[model samples]
Target: MPSLTDSHTFSLPSSCSFLISVTDTNPISLAALRSTHFYLLGEGSNSIFVDDFEGVVVQNKIKGLESDDLNDVIMLRVGAGENWHDLITTCLKNHWYGMENLALIPGSVGAAPIQNIGAYGLEVSTFIESVEFIELETGAKHKIKSNECRFGYRDSIFKNDLAGKVLITHVNFVLPKSNYMETSYGELANLNAPTPEKIFNTVIGIRRKKLPDPRQWGNAGSFFKNPIIDKSLLTQIQHEYPDIPFFCISKTLVKVPAAWLIDKLGFKGKVLGGVQCHPHQPLVLVNIGSATGKDVLEFARLIMSRVKEKFNIELEPEVRLIGRNGLIEL
Candidate 1:
């Protein structure tokens, strides 16, 4: 483990660089981070950096996972840098049931709120009871309630106002009590999954088979956030596309499959330089060997532009583009 004083920076995906400084697990380190010359603090996982970074990048390395039974619900208090998938399996092994559907989504536990990471029939926000953060200005750790989180589809206040400040220290989750679960995701629909363990293994299996691991491939899963369309507009989309898969989230907002849009628009498996859209799931952008941040940024922009022209509705990226280099805000 690197000591609190040591901070380093390295080139990743080219054209993108973050000045890594601070390994502070102690209160003093966090206080120092609050006053860091560079305000941006990021944890484990890759975020495509923008062009220039004038701020320091800090990664939260606090570690712990503990649970308490609250009669009807079990709450899990997980550390920020906890390996996400490992945490999923750990929940299953302990007989916790709500998070099984969310297995294999990349990034860390701290990021789950920022993206509201979800799959199958589960979203992290629904399970999130609260989040604790070291406020950037105050350097004081304060717990924020779920409603105050300002969560939306693949978005939260963390991405907006707290964009470069608060470092998540702990996340609290409320999980299901009994056997009730949801495995009705398109891939899981036909398969009969009777038990929690079976569901956990099956979900992990599906993710492994469909999505390339970021560890080996150097890619983030599902580069685009599935567009949420109004029901009337969704009807128009369905009529035009017909075969597109969708799920209803509210009376007006329906979640549309980004993979279907990318594949249908013919961007799937298309490679431009070292970057390529994943063959199996078009929404996933891959870094083949040493693709630079510029390559991925341009490809994603092209995809968004194409999707917008084809569908008349713009698609948005789920990943964050730090600095200001690699982003198409349309």
Candidate 2:
């Protein structure tokens, strides 16, 4: 058995029967591994192993970044295993404009589409042209256009219909050369004459201030998705707490910050065993030290129960929790 604590950001104590790192897309080799239980992993920023896995853990290390410069747009084919924040840094260095708003987000390029990773009012789905992947069962290669991915707020087909059935090989992105800054969200709105480089630096600064460094404190950023609720419910909550912050999604739907709700309930810096809810950003749950999977599950459940009882909104976990067999719902 091999220790998995160092593999994932949460740093929970666990091990797997086998740990394999795939640097290339070898269909035959991957297909053969399908005979046993296995979990696909990238940089392991968004996943936490809650217990000793009964089977193999396949780490995706497939790396490459190829670019095609079209006069108005730059087309990039990024390997699934490539670090996401590093890609954003490279884009900024090359004067690629659109991804600047998404700087400092952890995880791999492959995981980006699954979550439709977003920040500062910009989403990765906006620039994604298509996704290339290999079917684990049949060992056949396939490509799907971005529109067909069913991208939603913190969701996509990779997380639902195609999850656990395929392994991402590369992500195709098309970034326009034209300068269009997204300064509508939070601190970005305060930037004076913001450029891509400026936006990148600002976003990084905001995240650093709000989010804890995973190296110093074990954490998966934004443990829960901001719960989307009906306008009627938002009105009711607002009546009770006039300043309950929310983002209007549509005429009927609104996204209420999970952090606000948790913080209101006095869960900020709350601890259960060795796990603690982050004080600065209540959306994050951190492993203070020597935290076990049981502690994380219990602490999360407590928060979920309290939020539901008070707000009548169900909070869904953004982080994937892996148990002995596979992903478990909170």
Q: All candidates' lDDT scores?
A: 0.72, 0.93
Which tens-of-lDDT digit does each residue in 1-330 have in candidate 1? 222111211124322134443444456666655555553434434365534544455665667899998888898999887777888888888878778888877667887887778888777898899998877677677899999899977778888887766788889998869647776776667667457776777888888988887656656677788898888877787787777788888878888888988899888889987788898988788768767657766888898888888887688777656554323353
Q: Write candidate 2's Cα lDDT for 211-305 as tens digits.
A: 99999999999999999999999999988899988898999998888999999999999899999999899999999988999999999999999
Worst 10 residues of 1 by lDDT: 1-10
Q: Against the hidden reference, what TM-scores do the models get? A: 0.87, 0.99
Leading candidate by TM-score: 2
Error of 1 at 149 (Å): 1.3
Q: lDDT: which candidate is best?
A: 2
